[model samples]
Target: MPLVFSDQDLQTHNTLGLPARAAVATLDDESAIPDLCEALSSGRETDAPLFVLGGGSNLVVAARPRRRVLRVALRGIRLWRETTTHWFVEAAAGEPWHGFVDHCLSQGWPGLENLALIPGTVGAAPVQNIGAYGLELDQRLHSVVAWDLRAGRERELRADECGFAYRDSLFKRDGAGRWLIVRVRFALPKAWAPRLDYPDLRDYPGLGSPTGGAGEIPSPRSIFDAVCDIRRRKLPDPAVQGNAGSFFKNPVIDAGQADRLRHRYPDLKAYPQADGRVKLAAGWLIEQAGWKGRRLGPVGMHERQALVLVNHGGAQSADVLALARAVRADVQARFGVDLEQEPVVLD
Candidate 1:
């Protein structure tokens, strides 16, 4: 049987630190999954909606959720296989993402270096298709093992079937409650090359240019360290200031619209996409709209990085939403680009 708790305090669960509560079931082992499924099907548990939780880094608790929360605590890591060009590694869903990344690098696997300091669990990575420093999880993903609630069995989903997009996946689009991830597999390259294409990584002190210039090329460990240092300098620690990193997705717009915006603002930061669309920097827009370091109630955008929304202290979910709405409205009015909130809201 899984350990269960009632009226669980959720202030510590989410990085945003919003006050909320819910009945929670902790699943720490895979063997208990069948029992959980049976309980859910037999209605032995309350008939409330179910919410699967990981590290709680990418969430906002809007209210006391009248739901049963399944907190995935499953954990393990192993070298699944090795090919001529790749090292296949597998990790349980509940493993800490950064720790897993670091483990891979420490074991001499190099592909996950660029993703080093991201918060959340392994299972959550595929859902958001998390990316940073020019590397996305989809590029290293091999497959995902999950339990299908509707079908009442386990299924292995290949990388192609995941439908990965910019910060999105099939697990996010169609597997809300239907698919509960159990484990994730990654195919890290053996012939590794440092990804220094992103501006920050390229300009990192002492790390030679991508074409090999001023200094020695960074190893996987150095790249991992650099990423960690960069993130620590830019984003606030959740333990000190409650925040969900990168509050909004960079808005993608057609080339014509981007051109018009660039004509008006000249300094607008836009990246051209393969599909002829342009991705605008949400942080740049938010800062330009004058929301940076500004506070509404007890919530505000981080002064250092405008993209992060932080709770000053004693904040509620309402305050967070109010600030988000105001920020979104202002950016839309000014740039005509809609800012979509990235964190999942629970109520």
Candidate 2:
């Protein structure tokens, strides 16, 4: 059986360092899930509502949670299989995402290099289709092993079966409380080509590519190093500053609307997507609205990255939320774009 604790202090569990408590259970083995589920179904255990908790990097918890929190602690990683053209890797849900990426790179697995330094656990990766640089999780995901909370059964879902779109997945939509992902598999191509089309890599001279001239291809390790360096410079360290990285999602608007915004704000940064929609940089919008480095009591926008909402010290979830609403309202008023929050608020 998984270990159970009553009235657990969750301040350390969440990245934002929010004050919270709940009836907590930690799962360290997959075989134990059946027994736990049986207990829950039989009403042998408390029948409180269940909440799945991972690394808590992208969460804002209320001061008090009356639910039963299930913290996934199972851990392992392996090269599941390899073919002439691709490698299949598997990781346990509780494995730290960045650590798994680093492990793959050390083993010469190249596909995940562009997603370095991202916080959170592997189990939570598919929830938001976590992405960075020029790569997204759906691009590499092979399948997901999840336990259906509602059906009380374990099932496997292929990449296509997972409805993935713009920082969203089945785990986030209708399947939210119905599934608990226990493991994830990734397919990485052996025939790899470095993706340097992103403006960050293309504009930065030290990151290579721009100065490499024609026909120069950077190694996977170099790409990984550059991505790590860039993220470290752009985002605040969660250890020193309490924050949910990138508090808002970049708004996707129609090309016509984007053109109008561009005509009004000549320096506006917009990227044309393959689907004809334009992705406007949320950080740029917030910064232009003058929210960067701005503070509201203890809650404030990060000085370096406006998209990140930080808790300076002893800030409550309400305070952080108030600041987020203010910033969103300002962006909507100025640019007519509704900035959706990225963090999952658990009250």
Q: Pick the candidate with the highest lDDT.
A: 1
lDDT of 2 by residue, 1-347 (tens): 55565788899999999999888878888887787667667777666667788999989898987667889888999999999999999999999999999999899998998888899999999998999888899999999999887667899999999899888988888633467889999999999988777778666555544455655677787788888888899899898999989999999999999999999999998999999999999999999999999999998999999889999999888998999999999999999999999888777
lDDT (CA) for every model shown? 0.89, 0.88
Error of 2 at 74 (Å): 1.0
**Model 1: how far is 100 from its true place, Å?**
0.8
In candidate 1, where is summed lDDT lowest over 10 consecutive residues?
A: 208-217
Enumerate residue pairs that collide in model 1.
none
Which portions of model 1 miss their true places by more than 4 Å? Answer: 2-5, 208-215
lDDT string, candidate 1, 150-261, tens digits: 6678999999998999888988888456779999999998888889999998888876434446666677887888899999999999989999899999999999999999
Q: lDDT score, residue 24, model 2?
A: 82
